[model samples]
Each structure stands twice: as C-alpha cells, then as structure tokens.
Target: MDHRGGQVEGGTPDGESLPALLRSWRRRTNPRGIPGLATPGRRAEGLTQRDVARLTGVSERWYGALERGIEAEYSADFLDRLSSALQLSPAERRALYLKAVGRLPTLVLPPEAGMPEDVDEGLLQRFLDNQVPAPAFATDLAWNVIGHNEPLLEWFPWVTRQENQMRWVFLEPEAHEQLVNWEQDWARPFLGQLRYERARHPKNEALMRLERDILASSPAAREMWNRREVVEHSHGALRRLRLQCRRGQEVAVRIVALRPMRSDLLRVIVLMEDQRECGGA
Candidate 1:
C-alpha cells in the first residue's frame, strides 16, 4: 500500500490491496477489544464482523461484503461507520477510506517540542506601531492575551484580568453588556474555535485546564461548550465590537486578526473605527 501523497491506485510491488488492510483491521477489533462488550464468541479473538455490524447499524452481510471489498460503491457514511467500528483515529480513518478508494494522502503534524508559550512582545509592538490609529494585540493559539498596546489595554481593561479570551468574554458581566451582538457575533466563533482546538489537541494540558476553569466559573461558557460547535480562526475575518466609553457613549470597532508568522502562537488583532463612528466617546 503505497501511502505516499494520498495516491493509492496501483497496488504496491507486492500487489497489496486496500481490502487486505481492512481485513487485517477487522481481525483486531473483536467484541472484547472494545471497552464493554461480552467476549463469549467462539472462534475469533477480536470483535467479530457481527459485533461491528451491530454497533454500526449495518447489515452483517453488507459489512462482510465491505470488508471483503466485494462491493464497489461505498458511501463516506458507511466508511465512517467502519472507521468507528475499528476505533481508528481521525487521521487513520481518513487514510483508510482514501486507500479503500485508491487515493493516497495523509495528514502529518510537526513535532510539538518548540511551541512558544506566548506571542512575542516585539512582534506585538511592531504590529501596534504599524497600526497607530487602530488598537492591536497579540494572543496565543488558545486566544489568551499575550501582548497588547496601551491603546487596546486602555479600551479593554478587562483583558488584563483574564488570561483566556473566552473566559473574559463570557464570565465578565461587562463584556456581555459592552460587546454588541455578543451571542451572534463573538461567542459563537470563540466557543467554536475552543471546541475545535480541544478536538485537535485533546492532550493539551493548558487547554484542558482552561476549559475546566471556564466551565466551572461561568454558566454561559459551560452552555457554549456543550453545544460542541467547531471553527477555525481565519485571517481577515471581520468582527464588530461595541465599546462603551467612560463618558457613557458607544463606539463601534472593527476587529481584524494579523498573523506575523505561520506559527499559531502569535496572532495580532487590530481594532479600527471610522472617525465618525467614534462619536462622542
């Protein structure tokens, strides 16, 4: 199985087919292999074909045909069930399905040895320097404020109190009242990004701790987490935030994210508003 570049059409030098791989996987996932099932089966040691069929709601004969590669047409949904039955990781699942159809590609991540703890202060300063009129700050991949210019700190002092962005937004009462369109605008994407990150890096201790603290500290945060929405932070995404000034006037600010490098640790956010939009505040 030539597993290079997601192309898997012609068999390897040994003529190994995807069905061969499936069969091997099938042999490993018996009922006992799964966490809670009874292991009273007679012949096979691992999950029988019947166990997988029952768990995935597919006909035993149909699943058998699938395992045997006798069926040519297989839906992604069916492959998904098979993937779950085999307890394949997300990458493994994708690779298996792709191979089954003779395509070759796989996702690989860089080693996590040198990830930065926070965005660089110099980078944040440079970003803020370039955006003199706009407020800008650099945050970590998890949206924790790492560095912000005086202007941003002056405007959003609450950023200083909480390290986590979502925590500050939902836990702080002032954020709900100050941020216009809180639910429809920021909360949805913020929560979604958190969930997405959690799935991608389930073993991240900092992320897990942040989630636990937020869930315990704020009901709104818990509710949002329960919704299980997932999203990625995209560059140039437009966000609107309403800020209340000390003089009791409202200002509408447009927020944009700036990535100085491909690394997720540094994200500089710029806030801009038209002079007219500034109003009395």
Candidate 2:
C-alpha cells in the first residue's frame, strides 16, 4: 500500500505516482480547446476520467481505480486506448504500457507528431522517378499529389490534373470509374486512413481544410467518416485499378504507401504489377 494507504497497482508511483501523473496530465489536456475530437464534448475543458473511460473503452470504475493508484492490470489493447485517452507521446505511451501491462504494447504506434520538416530529395523523387512503367507518386499528409512520374501521369490523367487524391476520389466522378471495387478496395481504406491521420494532427490547418473539402463533396464519404473507423494502414492489400484512359484497361497491382522513418506526414505510393502481369509494366 502507498503512504496514502491506496493499493499499488503495477509499480509504486513512488514520489511520481501514476494517479498523480494522470491527475496532472488530465488538467493539462484540454480536449475542447485543442485540435482533437473533431466535435468537442459537452463536458468542461480538460480530460475527465469519464472521457478517458469512453476513449479507452474501459469502465469508469476501472479507469478511476487506475487513476487512484489502485492495483490493476489491462491488456496491451487497453493500454493503446489509454495512451490515446491521455494523448501521451510515444515514449510516454511506452512507459505507460509497461506500467500497466509490465511490457511493451504488442501493436506499434507512431509518435503523435513525427513529420520531418523536409523529406530528402533522393528518397522522395530520384528513387521513385526511376521506378519505370509502374505508376508511382508521393503525397503529403493531406494526400496531395506533390510529385509523380511520367508513367503515373500517362496512365491516369485525372491524377495529374488533381492536386489531392482525397478530393479526386470523392469529388471527381472519374475516380469511381478508375479505381476498381470503388467502395471496398479504394474508398473504405482511404477513408480510414484519413480519419487516423486527422486524429493525430487535428490542429493542422491544411489537414482540417482537406477534411472539410472532402466532406463538402461526398455524402457517402461523410457517412463513412462518421463511423469513426481507424486502421493501421502501411502498405495495404493488392488492388486492381481500372485506368481512366482511352481503352479503359484494368490492372491488378499492390499499392504501397511508404513513410520515411523520420517523417510523419510524407507518404509515397508505388504501384506494382502482379507476377502474371509481368512484361506488362
């Protein structure tokens, strides 16, 4: 038991107890005033225990006890939710996970803000540009087509014309025609990614604009967004995209989104043809 006579949970908070840390951090985190929570809550500013419970998907009683430094244990998943609830840094989150579960979380988590000021030119352009035949491009967090190669532009004119992929996917009528399995393959996954990125960078003005623009264009997109789904999307399943071209050809390729180790906001998408489609690219 602690000097306060409360049962110690994982490890003694010592002079720096978990409950004390929670209480301190909770006051410092103002959800309503912050860029998080797309829609602000009715509860007063700063994170409440109830808010933590809801965000972490744990019972108020359970979260409260943990907050009070009582003996407790939770799964790694619970720690993930708890980390988000507390809006902790990756390091801080890791520490919390160890404190709660006596180990690191099974799932990998990106830092709250890991975007580099600039992605090295060689990595972004020089390398991807050489990836011939296979359509390749780079995008910012907003999914804006900041750079691309001749093959990608030649295959998809709409991509060249449009500045942002999200805008094209939802607003441009041609996107539905070009991307096969529109709802399942392209739209849903992209929607989930947008939601995930937004959660991490809610205050970013450019990102906020992107979200507003997307919502303004498509009700279907809005409905999906409201579902509040988030996914850990690095490189996703192989997808078949129907090129919006003269012949309307369809090709199966794995689309990969690569993030540089140091950068949070930069993403590179490369198209790879299936082995059967070899000699085609």
Candidate 3:
C-alpha cells in the first residue's frame, strides 16, 4: 500500500501498482471460493501472509517481505509454487515476476493481451503445417488455441471456431460424438487441467467469463468444476477419435502434447494415427 518507495508501473495501465494487485487478488479470494486458494484459518475475507507462507512452504516473515515489495530474492520454483497456491495464471505469474524485478509485466505488449508469445509464431506455424495429414495445434497456457494446421480443422474445426479449448470441449454439442470416450478420456482429465488453469489465473477476464458461462449452462460442467480437482499435467495420449466429418469413421490416433521450452504458456499437440496397428486399408 506504500508507494513512497517510488511509483513503479504495474498492474492496470491506469497505474494500479503491484502491491495493490496482490492485495486485491488476495481480498477477493476465499479459502472455499477457488481451488488451491484455500488457506487454513482465514476463510472470512482474504488470505494473509501467514496463509501464503503456509501454502508456499516458506516462513511468514520471508513471504511478507516479498509481498511488501522489499528487495528480496526468490527462486523461480518457489515463485511457481506460490503462484499455483494463489491460483495465479500465466499472466499474473508474469506480472508478479515483473514486479519482483522492479519492472512491469506489461513492459512489452504484443498486439493481444497476456500473450508472452515472443517466440517465432510463424516458425511454429510452419512446423505445425509440416505435420500435414495429421492433426496439430498450439495452445497458450490458458488453453486458447492460437495456431493449428489445416488437417486439424477437419476433426477439431471446433477448436479453431472458438479460442478457448476448454470451452469448446464442454460447450460444444458435437464433443460427445467427436470424442468416443467423452466422459473418461476427454472431459474428466480436461476438466481437471482446466481446474489447474483456473486456479492459476483466477482474475483472467476471458477465463472467468467462460467459467461462469459454462457453470450456468451445463450442470455437468458445474459439478466437475466444483469438485476442484488439480491436474499437474494435461498430456494427451493414444486414443480413439470419431471423425465427425467422415461418415462411419473412427481413428485410433496417438495424441501427444508438448510445451515449448521458451514459455510455459505455449503448447503444441500432434496427432499420429496408428495405421499399421489398426490395419488401415
């Protein structure tokens, strides 16, 4: 709350400041409100430094120092876990990192918001295109499908139709038909992954909107979300997919998801059909 140290650009463009942002996020969050955000004693209003420290496995005083914007050193791993506990999304994590470095997260803004896509998106597109005849697509940390190959559109054109991958999975009527084992293979794990994502970026407008919309529209989705399951990873595996575009078509494809080394938000997925094992004519 004390900007007397010097006003540094952070949070909102209106110069909301970092400590304010942290405190705001904390105040709005309750122990039972969001997943992984629950702290032991303070469910009445907001989380305390003690709660954050307890969650991050650090001392209360140490956590307080960072929260107060004191010149303190923090490990990436520690920051990551702390972000997870507070349910800080990719954008929030980046912003928090920036504040720690005496810089603002919005220091470099691409045309779009929350896109740390400083990597060569064109080159990545080329790589995705090279996987022709196979379904390949890339998604940001929030699970927004950023890029994809033409082949991928044949089956998952829905993914391209909409930006949010989780929304498409849950909201689309055709999802049940597209994914053979919709409940177990697709929906459950995907929901858990979304749970993790939601926890990380509790303040993301798009994500928050999608969550509200889904919860209101679908009872199933609401139940899954309320369960508050946290999945550390969302790697796709070999599975059967129904080619909705093709009549009487079911393909056994091994779907693999890989995150780029440059940023945690960027993820690439490639689908390989096991033609030999499945005896393709």
Q: What is the lDDT of residue 38 in candidate 1?
A: 60
The TM-score obtained by model 2 is: 0.56
lDDT of 1 at 89: 38
Query: Candidate 1 or 2, higher TM-score?
Result: 2
- Please provide TM-scores, in order, for all candidate models, with all chains considered together: 0.52, 0.56, 0.56
Q: How many backbone clashes does candidate 1 have?
A: 9
Best by lDDT: 2
Rank the candidate models, highest TM-score first.
3, 2, 1
Overall lDDT per candidate, in order of appearance: 0.63, 0.70, 0.69
**Backbone collision tally, model 3:** 5
Model 1 earns a TM-score of: 0.52
What ranking of all candidate models by lDDT puts the best one first?
Answer: 2, 3, 1
At residue 144, candidate 3 shows an lDDT of 68
The residue ranges of model 3 lying beyond 4 angstroms of the native Cα positions read 1-113
lDDT per residue for candidate 3 within 3-97, as digits (tens), equals: 32214535544365656767776766566765565557645687777777888899999887776767655776677667766766445666776
Residue-by-residue lDDT tens digits, candidate 1, 135-195: 7776655566656677787778786556556678877888887777787677877888778
Per-residue error (Å), model 1, residue 25: 52
Query: Candidate 1, which ten residues in sequence have the lowest lDDT sum?
Result: 105-114
